[model samples]
Target chain A: MKDIILIGSGNVATHLGNSLKKRGFNIVQVWSKHINNAKILANRLDCESTSSIKQLKKADLYILAVKDDAINQIISQLKDITIVHTSGSIDIEVFNHRVSNYGVFYPLQTFNKNVDLDLSKTPICIEANNKKFENKLMNIARELSRNVIQLDSESRRALHIAAVFACNFSNHMYTISEKILSESNLDFRLLLPLINQTVTKLKDHNPSEIQTGPAKRNDKQLIDSHIIGIKDAKFKELYTLISNSIISHNE
Target chain B: MKDIILIGSGNVATHLGNSLKKRGFNIVQVWSKHINNAKILANRLDCESTSSIKQLKKADLYILAVKDDAINQIISQLKDITIVHTSGSIDIEVFNHRVSNYGVFYPLQTFNKNVDLDLSKTPICIEANNKKFENKLMNIARELSRNVIQLDSESRRALHIAAVFACNFSNHMYTISEKILSESNLDFRLLLPLINQTVTKLKDHNPSEIQTGPAKRNDKQLIDSHIIGIKDAKFKELYTLISNSIISHNE
Candidate 1:
């Protein structure tokens, strides 16, 4: 069994800790700057918790799941340990310069403490500085997930940007939709099945091939009606921008 | 059994025809401006096909799923018949002005002939000139779906605009994502679960509440990376525009 120490207590850290425990790996400890947050997860895993990185115990694997800005500071505190950061943008070399052996164990999915994450099917992107550490990282990833992808830092960053488009920007569009529906005093629930089907279509068909809209069809009457319906000035601008983009794509 | 005649052979018409046939409606005939297209669906439904609206048979319900530009001409041709067009933008009065027993029977979902449409749960937005015709349209909708919503032309137009935001614009975001992934030689399948989860979150959580990413967190560094990574000029502009919207929402 691999012994792992999680060096943060945010969503990614808690989720990875819980999933690792469920996969029968020995979690050595969980450390967070916030003692309570660290203890919450540590208590669940029956592992020790420490607010001080000085008290951090040695483990076979160390996962740094801190904020993007705090990654360097966290790695500075570690001494000659095999480390990995669950960051999409940060390079693996950030840890390489600071530690003897390092890698990236980035899970390409959004996580929340409230949401039940199934790591088994979630894609884990792994990269290591050395062959030995790479094998160890790959093994751990394989044990936890069937979809382990080895991406160079550049590719991982590219994937991360793609996720921003697919997940983050997509969620913002839903937020706009919710706002639109709410203003009309209609329950956003009315849009759920259509939303579900939109995502479902992406599973089997390319999004470009299945795209439909007044903008895509160049139906100016519907476009004009839509633009007139938006009350928020900023949202109205967004509607016009995206609608124009869709129309541009068709052209 | 309601005898229905389809007056177009587009995605919406074909999908509705197949769905109605499955639900045991006698599709008396399909009339399209294009004879071959009408024949395609008519053969599938084991019904009659005709290019000329002059040869159309009398039916309890006539569905004009034609393009918006062609809607008036089709309705003018089928005057004195109980005709309804499945249009979100056009007023039911457009039909009432031409035909005595006219209404709107708009299905508030995106349709592609290749995709399997689940009509049982798709909300059918109905509007009519009179209560008798309204009841007739409602009865037909009720037989086909459980979620029959009554909206005036104004609300249906609002709902249609919201659908553009939630479905069409959101789909373009997916297309942007697919393009980004294709640049890296990565399969679009990697992003499917993230896309699915984004939609799943909308069912139980408000879209704004479930929003994540650099924009949601105001992570300037990651957002900068994303803007730089997207090579397409238009996509980059879209990224900047959407990220600004998300950040504005948080503020």
Candidate 2:
């Protein structure tokens, strides 16, 4: 069994630690900024917990699942150990000097600790400095997920940006929809089936081809009427800008 | 059996007609601008097809599933028959002059003629001038869906605008994500799991509370990095606008 130490008890770390534990990988330690967070997750995985990097035990692999900003500081404290960070935008160079073997074990999926997800279905994007480290990381990734691919730093960064539009902006659209419904004394639950249907349609069709509504039709009358219906200046502005963008993209 | 005439061959009409047929509603006639389009649908329902409104058979109910713009012209040709247009934005007053009884039977879901959907799961928003007509439409709606709602013109219009943002804008974000991935020689399929997870999160958590990404984090450096990475000026503008909107919404 490969011995592993998990750094960071956040969403990504918690999920990864639990998944690793289920796969029979020996997680020796878990470290977090807060001792309680580390202890909570560590207890669940039957591993040791530490608030300090110095308390981290030696293991075959150290997975840094901390924030993108804190990865550099945490990397400086570890030395000459095989390590990987689960971040999409941050490059592998952050681990270059401090570790003998370094790579990226980024899962191209959103993680919410409370939400139970099938990690095996998630696409894990891997990057490493050499073939040996790559093989080691690939082995661990394969245990957790069926979809694993080698993605370079540039492509990973691009994917991260695309993710912002797909996940973050898309969620914002839901927020706006909720606001609109509530303002009219309607329930947000009314939109749930429609939301599910929109995503379901994409399984067989390209999003570009399936795009619909006033914007895609370029129906100025309906567009103007929709804008008039919106009371919030910010929402109206968003409606216009996104509408124009869709029109431009289609053209 | 309730006799009905379906006056369009588009996505909404196709789905609604098929669904009503499944429920044993007698569809007497199908009409469209072209005979071919009308015949295709009419054949499926075992109904008469007509290109002219003059050929329309008198029925207990007429479903005007045509475009919002063409509604007035079509209504002008019909007289003293109960009719309802399946539109989200248009008011029931469009049928006020030409018919003795008229209403709205708008289904709050996106439809594609080729795509099969459970209309029973879709929410049907119903409105009419009188309680009798309202009851008439409600009976039809109940046969097709469990989620039947009596939403007035004002609320329905707001809901329509909200649907544009939630469904259309959200799908465009997916299109943008696809463009970004394809540019980097990455498969758009890689984002599928991420997209599915994004929507799945909403089942338990509110979208505003669960929104993630650099913009939600207010990470200026990462947001700037993403903007710099975008080559298209239009996309860059969208990135900036949406990021700013997310920040403002959070505040």
Against the reference, the lDDT scores of all candidates come to 0.86, 0.90
For A92-128, candidate 2 gives per-residue lDDT tens digits of: 8987666678899999888888889999999999999
> Candidate 2: misplaced stretches above 4 Å?
none
The 10-residue segment of model 1 chain A with minimum total lDDT is: A92-101
- Please report how far candidate 1 places residue B177 from its true position, in Å: 1.0
Model 1, span B92-163: residue lDDT tens: 777646678888999988888888878888999998889988988898889788999889988887788788
TM-score of each: 0.97, 0.98
Q: Chain A TM-scores, all candidates?
A: 0.97, 0.98
Q: Write the per-residue lDDT of candidate 2 for residues B125-185, one digit (tens) a residue.
A: 9999999889888988999999999999999999998888889999999999889988998
* Model number with the top lDDT: 2
Strongest candidate by DockQ: 2
The top-ranked prediction according to TM-score is: 2
A196 in model 2: Cα distance from truth in Å? Answer: 0.8
